[model samples]
Target: MFDIRLRIPSWHRLHSFLGLGASLFFAFMFLTGTLLVFAPELDWLRYSEVRASPQGSAKLSLGTIYDAAARARPDWDIVTLVRSEGAWFADQVTGVRPEGRDAFLWVNPYTGQVNGETSSFTIHAALLRLHEALFIPGRLGKLVVTVFAIPLTATVIAGLFLYRRFWTGFFRWPRFSSRSRAWLSDLHRLIAVWSLVFFVPLVVTSLWYMVETVGLNAPATPANRTVARDQLLPPDFNGARLDAASAIAAATLPGLEVRKVILPRRPAQPIVFQGDHTAVLVRPRANAVYFHPESLEVLGAHRGEDLSLHQRIAEAADPIHFGTWGGLPTRILWGLFGVGLTALAVIGIIIHAKRVGIMQQKIAGASARSGFARVWRGMGPWGLGGWLSVGLVVTGLALLTRNFLGA
Candidate 1:
């Protein structure tokens, strides 16, 4: 039923070595990734009351929602208005207060009622920062995370070649009665094979993100250079501007469900409506309609289908990375797989360390200890488990301090 092979390929060794060396980073990614799956749900915990949907047959227009937000915080500058999830048609206004504090307010799209305001600092945001950038300061953190992706991608590629019998062992599981090493080995291989499809795509998407972030294939046009969403161009319009609701209603694609409406505060800037099709797995901003802010005339529109091959691949990265393409169930599945990958990394490290310990013992001719004892000692006081434990505690404390304790 199974082929007994004693020989391991060079790629297998390389894969194991890379995974072991990068186990902590991989673990961190996995842990944060699992948290990110329910990021929106986590936000609800912080804004339970504000996030609640109002019951009504008729929906209030975006103009009313904007008016409500303006009424609530007349002094604050509105940076963006995001369409909130669920049937309530709530809009989240994120902007800066005159005193310079970041402000976040919610408005019911149906009743034009202010749902309440909250600080911009959220648990979801913090965890996402950790996941995306590893808490390193600025783009450097993102660069560090991206740098680690190179090795991660290599590990996945090596694994594909290293475990050639993956298909054959697809249904196998670690034996409960086996020795620790045997059980771990079996479990590691089982996870590696079973998760190949998801693992490979995730790594590829990660690489794609890194490439995009570093501007490898960025659009050549000077106008196409992306601007940070929070960075505001000073408003030149002191007079009343055209309403966003009317502009979006007129400009949006027939099937496009608007997810965000970005207003233009400066001269010559367009009001952009970003949305997705009703189809599953489609990402927000998969299609966008840009309108002349004053004239309410369509300036330009870009749909996912209109992208070139390379651009399509680049655009597809986010949806695939977050598993948002398939909705909630897929997100849950990806979360579970993330956990398994983390566990696999731990197992891989332990197995490699154990083997290294045996080799060290043989070379040293030391009989002071044997088996797992030797392995444990070889791992030293701040070994894999020790480092991981410390990391977890520190991460928890950092997040708790920043969020709950306001450190």
Candidate 2:
């Protein structure tokens, strides 16, 4: 009789254990990250009752929108007016109905009407907090997330090494069988192989954020300081005297799509129109044109293309991590693929637990048959050595990536 039971390797068990241990937390991350893909749309749904329908007519000026928002919430401090697929204004955390929460006001761009106001306590905002910091307080929460990135990357790498058969098999689907463990194994392997390409960018970029966050090393961004003018505007001015439309018209760059119009808060501060161009695929806010609030004179212009390589890569990380670089299609794909990571974690746990139970049974039976005190060990010194080797490899790879890519 030929026995064809699949024999799991020692390193394979180690990797599976690593993933299984972190399965629950990683699953939370995956689910929350998926929701964050459409965060803006989901957040807007929280205020759908008062949301204004899009009008076909000409939109109101940014100045008008700011005034309407200010009038709607007299106590609120209007900070920025954003013109996206929709028009909205954000105010500093004014603690209105929801005490200690930031507020966002949606405006009817055509008529300068304050259409809707939403607070920071919405489900979307909570999910974002969870995704970024696990709802933990302050920098400590960020550190918790940053610390986990390395171990998570190690698990992914170990999984890749264990599945070497994938390349040789040309990614063949494991044959379907009535065996439950075999079926799950096949499915797991299939998803793991397909997901490896995306896993690299996901983990590497994540590690980059973690490293930067802990202040081990961080990417440098070009300094931007608001240039103050000696000539002051009228002290009694109630709002921005120059409108956003005129400022944008005077300062818009070639081939850039206007995304947001930021009205200056102080007299010396400039009205900035920020947007994206096809050249910079990373951040949608890659291009900027600044205009003096009173004079409407061009103060400065900045482009993402002008940034240094390291700065550009750092900026690109956000869009790549969020899968926003390629628009809605890419975001959907990222969300879908993110589910596979969760599945790998879950299935790895199940498989490891089942294997542990089987091993215990085998050890018990062997002890009964041999009557030997220590004869029934599941794995000997060889397995311990294999685990040590795997650990060393993971550590080396992570450090190499951090030093080279980050530096």
Best by lDDT: 1
How high is the lDDT of residue 112 in model 1?
Answer: 72
Residue-wise lDDT of candidate 1 within 264-368, one digit each (tens)?
Answer: 554445667777764334456657777554445676776777656666676677778877767678888888888888888778877876676667768866555
Q: Estimate candidate 1's alpha-carbon lDDT, on a 0 to 1 scale.
A: 0.68
The weakest ten consecutive residues by lDDT in model 1 span 220-229
lDDT agreement of model 2 with the native: 0.62
lDDT tens string, model 2, 1-407? 75443454565766765565555566667766778887766766665623455566666666676677767887654556666554442221222332433566767776776666655455555666667766556777677666668767887877777776666544667667646667677877887888777788888888888876777543443223356755333333334553644455444677766667665444466666667765555565567777665556677676888776766777888888888888778888888888887787666555555555556577745333221211112223434423442353344335444433532
What's the CA RMSD for each of the models?
5.7, 9.5
| TM-scores for all predictions | 0.79, 0.74
Cα-based lDDT for every prediction: 0.68, 0.62
| Model 1 CA deviation exceeding 4 Å by range | 1-9, 54-59, 88-90, 220-252, 265-268, 278-282, 353-364, 367-407
